[model samples]
Target: MSTAVATATPTARPTSRRRRRIGSTEIVYLALVGILVVAGVLVAMGGGNLFSTANTAYMLTQTSLLGFVAIGQTFVILCRSLDLSVGYVVALCSIVGATTMAGDPSRVWLGVVAALAAAAGIGLVNGLVVTKLRVNAFIATLGVGLIVKGYLDTQFKGPAGDVPSSFQMFGYTRVGPVPISTIVMLVVAAVGIVLLTRTRQGYHMFAVGGNVDVARLSGIRADRTVIIAHVLCSTCAGIAGLLIAARFGTGNALVYSYGLDLDSIAAVVLGGTLLLGGRGSVAGTVGGVLILAVLDTVFNVLDVDPFFKDVLRGVVIIAAVALYARRQIDPASSRARFRSNRRRDPVRSGARPDPTTTDGGASA
Candidate 1:
């Protein structure tokens, strides 16, 4: 009887898997590629040679410094923090590195070490100020940046000592048609990718940024994660500073002090890394960097006014952010939420449901 009953039972149906959705990061990357195509068209329209080897190399080389800084900024933002002091950190490190080099090739390593140490120290202080003192990251980092910039201004009026030959070589040397600095930027991005996607530390970082209270409940050290992120961000800025000094073969107190911090933030945020933290990817940030570089190149080729370019960029950023925000909602869930709200409404309880009613009970 048991065997007969088992045979008579109907077979269970297999559950269908939902198709995976394209995330904001991938969408942003696609948009970046589209922008590049548009930029190429603009260059052609402007009678500029966009496909020339010279232009390609120039774009890559120019992007390397900003790319490195943006990668670091991505890390910090992923941890739900901001590091406004990176611009000043870059300035201070470049000046210190060049001064230590003193036109002496043999001292290049020493200068590099000194610069990195200084950056790390500044990062540590920023971390402590945020994590220990409970200061808002924006205010803390900005204050620290002001202090660093003030000291830098007091120490040097203009460009300081010359960079060493060895240091300069790193920026100039190329593999075939590519600059070594570009290669370095690519490697840094790769490392960032691996760190965020494959490592335990990376998991903890996302957890912390996603929700600090939940992360702490889960035994993650949110404070330590933030401190580490700041240190890494500062280190990245220091590396960018070294590259900047190498490319210029000199360092100045104020040459690179402007716009770098803002650029990093813009690129990272545009890459679709959540400004609030938790979700992000290094690859998306790379696309973001490229988008910025392409836009700058196109604008220069077209001879657009610098002020107008800035305004255009601001508009683009706002548009990209708004598009991403709209994508965050699921139509199905939104409808379900509306239905749930209607069911709980006292007026709705006595009346028939109105499909056209909006959230505030107004007719759509």
Candidate 2:
């Protein structure tokens, strides 16, 4: 009889993993900080202060309205759908909310409920058109917007209805430089962050956005997710409508002319959410909103021409999208990350090598 033993070569552990480069979100904030610094210097050069009380207030006030809509835009974009009707939704809801309130404090709640209900209903229609009717999201939303606009154009000649002083507090009240509207917008953003990270619907949004076919294969109801996303998006637009009513004391039929539909989409894209969908964060969107706010402030302070403001904004948006396109997550990095995780979670992966295991046998 002879004994035979085999010694397996020990699997060497990776000594180090490549550090993750800064993510698109982190880079966005860094760019924002850079812009603030540069803008501050420019303003100071002109014998003006960028952080003046009035300037801060104005920047934040603008940010609040855009933030609300952008956050909602984030939801639908994450589900791979776009809502071109948000500007119109804001217009409609402002009219609905303000008209229902009719300058009566007691009717504020009723107005809010009515406005939100209307926005949600429109969202349902938009979703149905896309899902049930098999229409493209862009065309479906645009068509819905046109329908809403036609009604607005025919029925109202100018601003109508008014918000009472009590409701106006939502737009005017502030904690120091921060308006209550901005604070509420931040709260909404917090809620959005939680939804994306800790809820089933949030996960479904990602799954559906990643690939509708794959999502269905995995038992996710993609259409339902999109509808929910649009509803949430429209509800956010409704909240924005309330802000408009609060600030202006009435519903302005021309509010959509501010070009918010494109602005909100730009902010979403600026936040690093893929235009095609499936990847982004509310925090990032907030940062993007702030960036735009800063630019608006800077332009006002520098006395840049209104036409030039649009051009500059266009440049920034294009540059940002192009810059971040190179930084998207790649398969090589993903595999490396998996290996790194497996190494740290030895028991879970069971792939970690153990040098101590050996084989010994005796054969006759």
37-104: candidate 2 lDDT, tens digit per residue = 99999999999999998999999998999999999999989988999999999999999999999999
For all candidates, what are the clash counts? Answer: 0, 0
Top-TM-score candidate index: 2
TM-score of 1: 0.86
Runs of candidate 1 with Cα error greater than 4 angstroms are 1-17, 336-364
Clashing pairs in 2: none
The numbered model that scores best in lDDT is 2
Clashes of 1: 0
Error of 2 at 99 (Å): 0.8
Which tens-of-lDDT digit does each residue in 1-364 have in candidate 1?
Answer: 2221112334365465667878877887788779878888878877777767778787788789899889999988999999999999999888888988999989998999998999989989898999999999999999999999889888889888789787798889987768999999999999999999999889988998899999999999899999989988999999998887898888867855468999999999888888899988889888888888878877777888999999988888888788777877668868966876875684865776443333343322
Error of 2 at 235 (Å): 0.5
